[model samples]
Target chain A: MIWDWGFALEILPVLARAAVISIEATLIGFALAASLGLVLAVVRIAVPWTSWTISVLVELIRSTPLLIQIFFLYFVFPKFGVVLDAFTAGVLAIGIHYAAYCSEVYRAGFDNIHRGQWEASIALNLSSWTTFRDIIIPQAIPPIVPALGNYLVALFKETPLLSAIAVMELMQTAKIIGSETFRYTEPITLVGLFFLAMSLVSAALIRSLEGLLNRRTTR
Target chain B: MGIRTLVAMLVIALVVIGALATQESYQVFMPGLLQGAVLTIEIAVLGSLLAIVMGVLAALARMYGPTPLRWLATVYVEIFRGTSALVQLFWLFFVLPQFGVTINAFVVAVLALGLNVGAYGSECVRGAILSVARGQWEACTALNMSRPQMLRRIILPQAFVAMIPPWGNLFIELLKSTALVSLITLSDLAFKAQQMNQNTFKTIPIFTLVLLMYLAMSLVVTIGMRLLERRASLGLARGKAA
Candidate 1:
């Protein structure tokens, strides 16, 4: 038989546990991306002199493949006296890599804010912090939520790359299972289905989030 | 100009020059890496061509083909797009042989990456075609052009320009994805770097060279696409074309 139902059923539990690691990595990495990306975006905007250097950094990170980035973090950083474990390195690599892409999205979000809004905040005698926190970010973020959500899904897909560093995520776990049982079909197919289902679910959720934001913004 | 920028620049320069300064070590690594890069470029180019063809075909099938073909194309896009390229690569490389169908790793790499990128490219094609003004389609109908003739002679040329930048992005993406092909035991640059690292334990130089090579390749794609876009839009100059 091409696919053994019993074997698939037997391995489902092991794959599910590993999937939690993948999900945890995605959530934590995305949180880092979302936050670090905002900092990178804000730094680029606020520090006019630093913009050139920041952009070059962003471009450098963005252009290189994430796998190499992960490998570099895993393999090379120890030479510089910074050591990180496989999972930590994988998550950090994923976080920093996506952060570059996310910063661009956030920068675009910040750009859409009208100049008058900044002027109004200044006219109201608000501190820069108050202006950004109370006025600017709230406005800037809603429009870009959908864009950020897309990255969330993108980051989830990238969780599989962590397997390269031996992070024991779903993909790596499945690979191990495949090697152990020599049944690549079931474990790999299940992992693919899990990804497909999660992506579809997240996509639908993002659509609803878009609808929610649109209605709130329109009001 | 600032200290931070200077420091960053200096660090990068030192790393790069440090890697090159040692001629003995450079000789050890550079040749193997360059050979791997050639293979990487070959796969990327072939994969990109296949992606463009599959993209245009799938986009057309989804947009204007018979209902079943449309459904098939949609499924193709969603399935391929939904899964990570790595999974798709492993499946083809490992699983397909179970059914008594075995292909070489290089063919598997190209097929997997091409089809995967093609799924995303179909959307680019669809978006570009949709962005072409509604009036163009009307004019084609008014001229009594057949469906294929209208798409071929009238609709596509205009959409082709809009598609270039997005296709350029996809091309770079395809290039980066070529790195994944290394995972399937193909001797691409990434694979070569990993191999050399294992052998020589010179992580810094080998990986740095590989990263720089990829960055250079992506920059070339970016520049080439910009030139193509300029050339494409030349005939469609706004006032002149009208």
Candidate 2:
């Protein structure tokens, strides 16, 4: 009836195990998003021919909800003979959805590079790939680190949506515990606390990373 | 591509999709989805209004309230912002009943979403207010205006222009979040799509329709906010001159 400390203590291990799955989803999903986003951003800028389509695709993904996107992948792709397990579908959905956003951040980072930098790279007769690798990305990525870090936190929070397709992430695990034991207060409250603590930790880490980057750049 | 070419192509694509959706097969799902869209829009509208009010109040409290009030506002903003919206919704929907508080699902959806978005909105509000030049506040004080009077006539009008774009963003985020309310059994657009999919197993058409509907709503919000930003900036110039 009331908050039970014993029950809360008992479920801590279960929640911790589930939290690892959620963490795995977040890390993998974020890595996918960050890389895919960089590729999307570079394609839009470097290859003039593909810019419009890429831009529209990014817009469509960014505008739609991630929940529906996950459903589309998990549910609809089977009709096209490309069925994916729930975890895969959920990870792909989150990665693609946030890639749209992360691409914009990358684009903004790229835009901050002076026009002279590109012209200089061209004047030096450097290949586009070499220019992007040696000149553009190194300068662009540092500033956007904080923004990407925030998305890492965001993706972690979103792993619970995987539970909609039965991925057994933290929230879903907690929900099951609630259903079986009929005491949601402990598990759900613990889930909330886990999210809060993780996000705060990530936020602090991001701040330190920002400071470190600033020091290196300035030096 | 040229803007004209892009618009023309987009319109053509929509027409093609629209014609296909008119077939009897797809028509069966429309009424249910439309009903859900209506509820989604309703929740988004109500949630946005509540978010704005809470945001402004919290920002003001954090900035100008006494120490205790500021601390309370800080905790509210941090706790709400730090946790997931779905968790907030579930805690409200499932856990509160144990505490003898049984809110209707709709109320819980709006409240959970409004409070969640409001936490982020407060930061936007705070930033906008802080960006209002210190000179403006001093000028208001020089004219012997009270804090509330200064905020009403001078500070807010200026900060409002800055707030519109971020508020627009928060509103769209709120709209996307309404999809989560379906999990609580409110049957909003996303919920309706999943329900229809379960029954008919027509996942592709159903999800495509729902995604497009969501895209259309977000586009409308985007355009509306852009127009409002333009109007606000125009007013901002007049305010600045005065």
* Candidate 2: stretches off by over 4 Å: B1-17, B235-242
- Provide the lDDT at A133 for model 2: 98
**Model 1: CAPRI class:** medium
Show where candidate 1 strays beyond 4 Å.
B1-22, B235-242
Each prediction's TM-score versus the true structure: 0.94, 0.96
Cα deviation of A62, candidate 2, in Å? 0.9
Tens-digit per-residue lDDT, B183-232, candidate 2: 99999999999999999998877888888888878767776787787777
How many angstroms is residue B206 displaced in model 2 relative to the true structure, after the best TM-score fit? 0.7
Q: Candidate 2 lDDT, tens digit per residue, A1-219?
A: 489999999999999999999998998899999999999999888899999899878878877788989999999999999989999999999999989889999999999999999999999999999999999999999999998998888888888889889998999999999999999999999999999998889889999999999999899
Predicted candidate 1 versus true structure: per-residue lDDT over B89-144, tens digit per residue = 98898889987899999999999999999999999999999988999999999999
Candidate 2's displacement at residue B12, Å, is 6.1
Clashes of each: 0, 0
- Candidate 2, clashing residue pairs? none
Report lDDT per candidate: 0.90, 0.90
DockQ scores of all models, one per candidate: 0.64, 0.71
Q: Tell me, by DockQ, which candidate is best.
A: 2
